[model samples]
Structure formats: structure tokens, C-alpha cells
Target: MAHVVSKSEMRHVSVEELRQMASDCRESIWAQAQAIGREPKIYLHWTAGHYGQFWDDYHVQIDEDGEIYVYGELDEILSHTWRRNTGAIGVTLLCGYQANTSDLGPEPPTAAQIEGMARAIEALADGLWLTICKEFVATHGECADNETNDWCHEDYGPRTTCERWDLEYLQTDESPAFNPWAEDGSRGGDVLRGKANWYHNQRG
Candidate 1:
């Protein structure tokens, strides 16, 4: 399980600084993923509440060898799945309140952050054979059949027609309202922006 940073801990850091940190973290995660030999896929939750709110935790990807594929803001991860974050890296951003709504008052991740995350997921997928829905069901139970619309419900099972958050959307660039950072300036904006270039350069 990846360690989630707290809001108090992130209070003083500048967006630029966080961005650099996110970059370094992503690099480390990618290297770890490569070493472990598993395709990396990250699961993100809007723990901080609604669009435009800032997040304080996130979940990351972990390779079979225990290598963590870290990406996105650290404060967005609400909690870990039953599988102990094993074979998957979990990251959490520190925003949002106990309520499901953003009324608690934290900014969500920015568009740039979301884009960066998308790129990272793409890279990890390209490098490894990823099974998003299978892993999600194995760990978090199937989405409810009709009880709750939450993707984490157990009844939903392996979705064949409907797209499960784990399997379909996270891997695609078309995810709805998916912003990777909280309002840009709240944390790590610059780093997320630079990740693609960094990744490209490193690949070369």
C-alpha cells in the first residue's frame, strides 16, 4: 500500500514544487513497474467531492513484484481495497470531507493533472497486460446489480455492457469530468504538465 500524504503535510508546498515531486514520483513508479513485469493501471476516486474541488488522496498502480506505479495527486485516495493494495499502488489526495459532496470545501485536481495521469496510465498499459475490471472485482467486489450506482458495488460484477470505473474509463482519455489535479495551483500542476515530455525523453 502506498502511503497517503495528509492535507496538513501538503499545506506549505507550492504547486511547482508539488509538480516536481509528482514527476519524480511518477518516474520512480514507472521504473518500479518495469522491474516487476506487470502492466500498471491506476484507479482514481473523487474522494474530495464534486468537480472543481481539490483532492487530498489517490490510489496508484503496483506491479506483481511489489513495484509501485505512482501517479496523480497524493491526497485523493479515500481508502484501500480488500486486496491490500497488492499488485496495485493506491494513492490518496487529502481534500474532501466525509460527505459525498464537495461542500466540505477542497479544490479538485486540475485538467493538467488528469491529462498527466492519463498519459501515465497509457504508458503503463502499453508496457504491461492490464486487466482493469477483473482486478477491481477481485479486490473491491462487483458494483451493485441495482442497489447502488456506485461502481464499487458487488452486484455489478464484471460489467459486460456498462463500463465499470475500473475497467473501461480509467484506461481511456474520454473519462467524464476527469481532472487529475485540484484547481491547478492547489498542488503539483507544473509537474503533471511536464511529465509527458519527461516520459518521452526518458523513453528515448
Candidate 2:
């Protein structure tokens, strides 16, 4: 079977390919989970804050260079978000979404990577029967939009500043960008939930 990836060049990757990448990064992810002492069930996607840097803090990880990784014990909620870690799953994209310069890095995520991201979300959403939730969306990352100053102190739910990717751009048929994830959470959350719902509806 061939992998027909979308024009995310549109950046990102295939979920199956991303899963294989996760297998490669398993050991480190296990080590991170051991140190954090958390368990999760909900899926949250993220990217490394720096370019060319991949970490096991999240269950699954992807790099700007288009490398994919999976951390062990992903089903167990880890400590990415304090209050939100109770029943959550976390995935990280290697490049920063809102951060340009040293954040997004010289190379941003590829179309395949983003496509994989959506697929991965759909897979998990179907697996867990997750409802529509903006657990991954956060305005902590760098953005020209001063829409909301600061994370509003968990009042919105989380204080993490790494949710820089605008996934909304990927949800539409419009051309996807290498640096397209959003911090609004709502924008990107729709894509995540939409895909998940579609998968669920299809299974029926």
C-alpha cells in the first residue's frame, strides 16, 4: 500500500508512518513517563519548542525534519498539563507553531507530518470515543496576535505556551503551510474533533 499524503507542504505526515516513528522513540518516552508519574487517556498534540529538538515529554513526537516518535505508556496521563493531565494523551510536533525565528526553526513541519497529525488524532479519538474538546489548543506560544495577553491563568484551562500550531488551516481544503498550527485551540481543536467524529460516524 502506498501512502497518499495531502498537500500540507502542506506539512506533517501519515498516522501509520507517525506510529512507526513513535516506535523508534519509545525508550526515551518511557523514561520521561517514569520521571513524571502521570497517566492519561485523552489525546493532546504538541511540537518541540526548538527546531531540531525532539523530546519524550509527550507520548508521540514529530520533528520539523519530518521525524516521528512515540513515548511509552501513552495511555497513562503524564505531566504536560497539571490540571489537564488526569485523563489526557499528549503528542508533540517537533517545530513550534506560533514561534518563528528560533521557534518554528529554519525548517517547519512538512505536509505529511501535519496530515499524520490529523490522522493520529482521528485514530485516538475513535479509539477512546472522545468528545469534542479543545484540550490541545493554547495561546502560550509566540503569535503576532495579541488577542489575549498571557494564558489568562488556567482560567482558560492550561498555562502551557507551546500550543503554537494553527490546525484550523489544515482542516480546510486550502493550501496548508509548513508552519500552520494555531494557538487559539478552538481553530485547531475543530480539526482534531472533526476528524475524530468523522471516524466514529464512519465506523457506524
Best by lDDT: 2
Let me know the TM-score candidate 2 reaches against the reference structure: 0.50
User: Native-vs-model 2 lDDT?
Assistant: 0.44
Candidate 2 residues 7-107, lDDT tens each? 23223345555445445444544454445553223444445345445454565555554454555455544555444444456655555445432233444
Q: Which ten contiguous residues of candidate 1 have the minimum total lDDT? A: 163-172
Runs with alpha carbons beyond 4 Å of true place in candidate 1: 1-41, 47-79, 91-105, 131-204
Whose TM-score is greatest here?
2
The sequence of per-residue lDDT tens digits that candidate 1 reaches over residues 1-204 is 335443333343333344444454555555554555533334433233433233323444322221223345433323454322323444322223332221223343444445545354334333333322323222121221221223323443223322222211121123322232224322222232234345545556
| Model 2 spans with C-alpha error above 4 angstroms | 1-43, 50-52, 64-68, 97-105, 132-153, 156-186, 195-204
Please give the CA lDDT of all the candidate structures.
Answer: 0.34, 0.44
Candidate 1 lDDT score at position 200:
43
